[model samples]
Target: MTETTHNTVTDERADLLETLAKHRQFLRFTTQDLTDEQAGQRTTASELCLGGLIKHVTSTERNWANFIEKGTSVMPDFASMTEEDFARRADDFRMLPGDTLEAVLAEYAEVARRTDELVAALPDFNASHPLPKAPWFEPGARWSARRVLLHIIAETAQHAGHADIIRESLDGQKSMG
Candidate 1:
């Protein structure tokens, strides 16, 4: 039996949200006490930075949440992206000029709040839509809102691990022991 709260989420939804929150906290903890420069600095061979990870996760969550409501129209046709499009996407992995840690974190918080509200208010987890046409996605494949939430959780957890590594490299800090 699933319990509902004032926000009206089922027990399953609450579990999903709790897991997502834990990962988000781990990711955000990696950037604590860091300056913008430090946040943006790439600490490893890969082009990932703490601030960029936060930005990328925020964008990803926003897009997926939009997909839950609007379907494939919310996603870009990755198969047809041009050089400029690719370049712009690459920017999601870097801290561009004038990008502030504070602003990035603020945006992520807003996106997260929206996603949490969306999850709470969702009428059904089984509602699904065909995936946008992309090379990586199988043809005719569809994903339910529940699946999308799981994907988001996986993405956040994966990147949080990456952020932990980057943060450890940047400084002596660890998100966990």
Candidate 2:
């Protein structure tokens, strides 16, 4: 019984690590094995591309880590953010001429590390923070910090799936193992 219980606990922790690792892998997939032009190219008519997605994710991490966790009112500017900005970022897309896959991948890894650190340090998953209670959320609904983390994770995974399809279409690259 003791051995079984220990194994179950270890399995749960491993599962969490795996989930976080998957998110990190997706960021790498979006940034790696692509040219500056190729990274910025969009398959769909919309502005979505691997580079753009990376930029989006970077900005999201900043918001989550800085504003949400650290209690800062400042947020990144989404409207003026360009492909150059996204391409330069390992996790975020910036469309500068010299932006390389290496830079973007490095940044993505860093962002993932920071995010993991913050999430792991949370005292209570159920602890309610202020943002969800702001005017943005529905009147009767208040969101806990945990809900935000889960939502971001879900959103990242969804976009990572999109990035994989787009990247594959762009260069016949397989994003998953």
Best by TM-score: 1
Q: Each candidate: what lDDT?
A: 0.94, 0.63
39-118, model 1: which lDDT tens digit per residue?
A: 99999999999999999999999999999999999898888999999999989888899999999999999999999999
Candidate 1, residue 80: lDDT: 90
Could you estimate the TM-score for every candidate?
A: 0.96, 0.69
Q: What's the true lDDT of residue 2 in model 2?
A: 28
Least well predicted 10-residue stretch by lDDT in candidate 2 = 1-10
Task: After the best TM-score superposition of candidate 2, give how far the Cα of residue 123 lies from its true spot, in angstroms.
Answer: 2.1
